[model samples]
Target chain A: MAHALEPQAKTLAETGPGASFGVIQGLDPRMRIVVASVFSIVTVSLSTIPGLIAALAVSIGVLLMSRLPIRRTLKRMAMMDSFIIFMLVLLPFTTPGDAMFNLFGFPASWQGLWKATEIALTANAVILSLMVLVGTMEPVTLGHALHKLRCPEALVHLLMFTIRYIEVLREEYMRLRAAMKVRGFRPGTNWHTYRSFGYLVGMMLVRAIERSERILAAMKCRGFSGRLLLLQEFNLTLRDYVFAATLCIVCIGLLCLDFA
Target chain B: MHIVDGALSNPVVIGGAIAAAGGIAMGLKSLDLDRIPTAGVLSASFFVASLIHVPIGPSSVHLILNGLAGLLLGWAAFPALFVGLLLQAVFFGFGGLTVLGINTVNIALPAVLTWIIFGRLIAKGTPVQGAVWGGIGGAFSIAATTAFVAVSLALSGDEFLPAAKLVLFAHVPVMAVEAVLTGFAILLARQVKPELFYKGASA
Candidate 1:
């Protein structure tokens, strides 16, 4: 029953559209990831409307420079916006403050509106920064960057393997779902439905474990060590440094404005 | 229940991150070399499990299955869930990187707790008994996660109290659904591959 609800993973493009040709894409993947994360921290820390607006502008500017696929980004933003919209609707009535308006005789406060705006703007700002910076780099590159940044080696390896096998497992799950559908399995709130879905997930895990054994054997045959060694090396160039500096300065300026 | 970025106050976020870091370090230390592949495979299972949505009364909610992960993996559930959350943030943007620590702690802590509370019961019981306990652990973990998420939000500001209450109320249905689902899953695993549960016990 749960298998019926599984959505396919998004098919990643060779290089994400619009991001392929962007100036940000030209920077080191490590630099982009670090800077984007720093920017996101700043955005999340923001409380003031003016500070949030400034951060949103910076995010938009980066998005325009990155030239990421606008339609896709907007679609994702719309999905996230649903939560923001819910918060906005609820906050006004629930938050106690100087009443700014009334909806159906319910008091809506200025403070509520401001808080919602802050949350919505900050969410957008951080998301846009991620779309431009982290979204542009390949997953493997990002994994390598994380490894280089001295993240736990086990974690790095686990991330890489998970990425490699997610699609395989999803495909396996789809096949099982198709088979169940052929047998006229319909999802409902019942014991049979729950048991069947449980079997499906249990079967998937069984297959995954077996496949991992084969994978480990194959890696050993190829002289694989416990640590992952990448052939590609990243060097920070002058342009990369400049990009980092500019992003940091912009973020720091936003923080200062919030204080001001 | 993922807490989105910017929703949490600095102290809550920072505190969650530190506590989560400690959990992950402990998880890493407990993760043996032989179990690395199993950890990765289970992590992927968790990653893909979120795509499975269960339709309840008026709406549908995706499966978290953190309970199943914990029942099988024990403390190792930490890194597995962290990786899944990381990928979800990067690819789907369901949660953001800045709030990863809080989100991880909220979701995974209950999983670890489930193991602590139910691990022995599940290991020692008959298949039916295991299934019953699994259901309790499943429902209990979701309830715990909702509380953590609510606390994280309410701690941020009084303005979020309503949202906090709503978050808990909304998940009530999900809790029941996951309870049934997890119960059945444990029954199946016990019949076919009881070793999975015992492995966690020994660990």
Candidate 2:
């Protein structure tokens, strides 16, 4: 898991238009957020096998055309597969159903098994589709999306600031951890060590707050407006309308197939 | 704990979105500029803290600073959390886009509740007790919320017993670690930058 996150972190550090598809990459950041958010909602609402299959198909089609590497995208999906699978495995035992097999002198119901399998598949499919959606979108795009959604200006500003300071706080945490390692501070199940960790986190917060204050102050000193400058413009182009309509049509078609 | 998109039902996911938006609206109503940096820093802390995963018996769990969030930000933790979770969902795919709202509520609700309860508890001027209870509150609040999340997921017509037990049991050690970390963080604030805890100490 740690290994998986490292590449993602690196990928994030190396973000640029050259690294992503022209459409997804070029779309206003806010628009991408809106599209991704809407797509995710549409994807998760799908439960039936056919419905999920259609959503998964649309997601995969998007991914293939998005210009991102399939290997990297699959790795992202595979990284999270374990946790979703772990959650899914429990479905068969818990969902009500007819007997399938005896486990430790208990009958495992067939109905339970089928229900579990369906739910598991649905969960995995939805998760995978959503992963593809997010994996293709950028953070700035998401912020822009929230802004467009009429999210409060204060909230939008805070999110932007939070993104700006992620690296700074991350650096502080690394330095602190290294210091702890140098001090031979191996945290055990002891009160003293626990207290030390808490102190580090609290102190980190204080330092972060101090740094943010200076940063915000410096920005304000430069005639900072309440809004950060967003340069990208996304209009309702023919392509965007086509994309939305096709998505709805595909989703509806899948629902019909499932019921049929 | 990041929830990936499509992992939850649409209704639950949509409900979470509405709730997160509502929480942010209420939080915005009470915003002060002085608190902006604190909120931003807390969001950063929340993001970074999630990256640190302590090993425990074949499964490793990371720190979630929702408790710390409550201790510092109180009511405003909600919007900070909503945005943070959304960011995590987008960049890391740690949680899914569909379930962003639910995941945010799961983590932020405890922090908000802790703030409500701990706000009064800490105001009594007992640093040590405050830190201790704050630690306890942080620990139990998250655990309680996780349990609720599991049970809710189970009851969502998608099987219940095994999954619920697995999730709840898996979090036991994680909660302990959180308590310890939250406790120590507060204690440190008391000692070095004591003003973070008490207003007129040295600010």
Candidate 3:
């Protein structure tokens, strides 16, 4: 599990300092999150190619301005784009419309191609916007921003704890995995393997429960209450307002293009 | 089985958000203070569970384990699975932020349903019986989730119908694997720590 989480942990660590150096990183995390979410919603709502193209342009502009590692961002986008490409291939074959071409003796529809492109553009635009906006911010900052945004308190706390303990649990899992490997146990597609894996998961859960008990005890010893006290203060600067306004105007313009 | 952002129409997205909010509220209301740590730890466990990939026929599939979660956490599965989905979106980009609500609904609703339908059986049964019922709950939850995901996509447009079908067909193997895994998990839990199921039931 630690091995599996290495890439994610690395990405998170890489983004932490890079976020502070980004062009839009100066804005309040709340503002950045709100603007990015709004932009993504509008991007998803787009139906016309022109509208999507404009949304993509806005996203790219933010990406360039943020100075995120371009190669890493593109690699993530490509991973997401593979799903869209799958949709592209399937939609053309399954959708009903006037024939645009023949693929393996099946009539591919223009409407299918159109819808596929629409989905592709919408997904890409949203992914790019997130890479620039949410990806740059620290998870704790994002959690605080969500709390400020009126997200449910329980959900917010859950997110924080999940992030905090994920590494710990991954380490525990790696130990278990190592133990299994040392015993020459390799995962295979068989009932014996499934049962062994189940025991592994069960053991992990048992440990997790016991660990949580210890955590709760520690928290209570410290007079910990249900409410988390966030120390980070956020003040919206003039540049934040300007950036948000610009993003809103661009989003609205793209929406108007969708109707046009 | 996570749905990416921009995959659904506005109406579907709005509806999913509303429904998810209701589930999360119920989950939070039922969650007591002592249960909080358990929920958090279980949530983290669920998050890490996704990293466990098991070999299938020609391909490997990762664990979703919403069934086992529901069996152990009941209504809390909503928030637990939601946190997992949130982190997955944040770190791996497996899903999107905007569609988090819908994705939450698509996955967690089945979890809650399984809890409602099978939670009691697991609580009352012997080890072997618990495994049997747990297996049913596991496979049933996956099937229900695939159905929910398919309906969400199909509701978006006629053009998405094929994708919807594909999502369902793709999960068939996952359903079987989850059943076996959940069965063994339940068996082990019943033998090792029966208290977890009892606590889940009382919650």
Candidate 4:
């Protein structure tokens, strides 16, 4: 499912307004990692309405500056919002605070709603920041950044393989799923067929592993090295410096906005 | 659910990070080259489990065999999960870097429990029965771990209840899907990969 959408996501991310502002399109993966980590921390630490609002404003500003088409970004944001709405709906009924109203046997409180809104918004912020970070950065570059951070070597190796194989797996999954669909394995809305659903997963897993083994064997036959050698130049040029400086300035500016 | 970095209470993230480090260290200490096939198969199986979804209510959820992983790999599931989630984070962005530790613990806890349960039941001589328990054990373990994660997030006092509940409730349907899928997965192993379940069987 995810594999099929990769090309679409990659294009939308690159061509969208977020990409246009050069926020995600130009930054080094290393710097994007730093920025994303910092933003997430700051967003989580924020509690008050003013603080959240300020953070939201900065994120929106960055999105706008990315120069990707606003409509494309909005469409993506809308897709994300639908998922957020599920959480939003639960807040009014389950959360307790200063009562705002009694609707359909549920007590809706102003405080609860406000807090709920914050949760949803912050969740959006987290996803949005991540979108920018990933959209702009290359996968291998990010992998290197992880390596540079002294992340476990085994983990790095495993992660690199998983990412590399995800596309392969996705393609394999699609073929199997399509085959199942053709075999009339329609998953209905009923619950009884869920058991069969489990069977389907088991079969797919077996097939995937079988396929991976073959792939692994084939690679070995070719004397495949474990590492994926990146061909991109990693020189820290003047442009890279400027990019880092701008991010720092933005971070400082956001902190000041939160404080002030 | 992948817990992103900066989402958890600093203490939870930091503590999880330490525990994960210790777990991986332990895994490496016991690591044998012969388990390569087991690790490879289980990892691939784990990856595929997430692809097929079981429809429930208004949403759909899929099988994720952190429990089965634990049953098969025991302590080794830690490194496997850590690696698996890190890959998921990078390739699909299903999770993030900072949340890697939390997600690893969430998935590994079940895998370890399943391993323990598998050990006990498989010793009883009925491989089928062992597989059944292993399946249920895997499902319940995942649910328990998920709930624990939810509670931990709520306790972080970041006004996380709504977000937490969203996650918890979403899994209600997913938990059932995982339960059924786990059972079926174990059944397949019992038939075709019986050597994987039996201690002395030749691979």
- Candidate 2 per-residue lDDT, tens place, A103-161, comes to 77666677666655555455445555554555555555556666777877788778877
| Residue-by-residue lDDT tens digits, candidate 3, A71-181 | 777787777777557667888778899999897799999888887777778788887888678767777777888999888877788877887788789889989999999
lDDT winner between 1 and 2, please give it: 1
- With a 3 Å backbone cut-off (N, CA, C), the pairs that clash in candidate 3 are none
Q: Which ten residues in a row have the lowest lDDT in candidate 4 chain A?
A: A11-20
Model 1 CA deviation exceeding 4 Å by range: A1-10, A13-21
Give the CAPRI rating of model 3: medium
- Winner on TM-score between 2 and 4 is 2
lDDT of each: 0.81, 0.66, 0.83, 0.62
TM-score of each: 0.94, 0.88, 0.95, 0.80
Best DockQ goes to which candidate? 3
| Candidate whose lDDT is highest | 3
List, for all models, the DockQ compared with the true complex: 0.56, 0.53, 0.65, 0.35
Instruction: Rate residue B6 of model 3 by lDDT.
Output: 67
Location of the lowest summed lDDT over 10 successive residues in candidate 2 chain A: A1-10
lDDT value, residue B16 of candidate 2: 76
TM-score of chain A of each: 0.89, 0.83, 0.92, 0.78
Top candidate, metric TM-score: 3
lDDT of 2 by residue, B49-133 (tens): 7777665555567778787786677667888888777665555445566666777788777887877766556534556776787
lDDT per residue for candidate 4 within B95-193, as digits (tens), equals 555557776777786667666655556434565675567557766777777886787678766456767866877676666666666676667755665
Please give, as one word, the docking class of candidate 2.
medium
lDDT of 2 at B148: 62
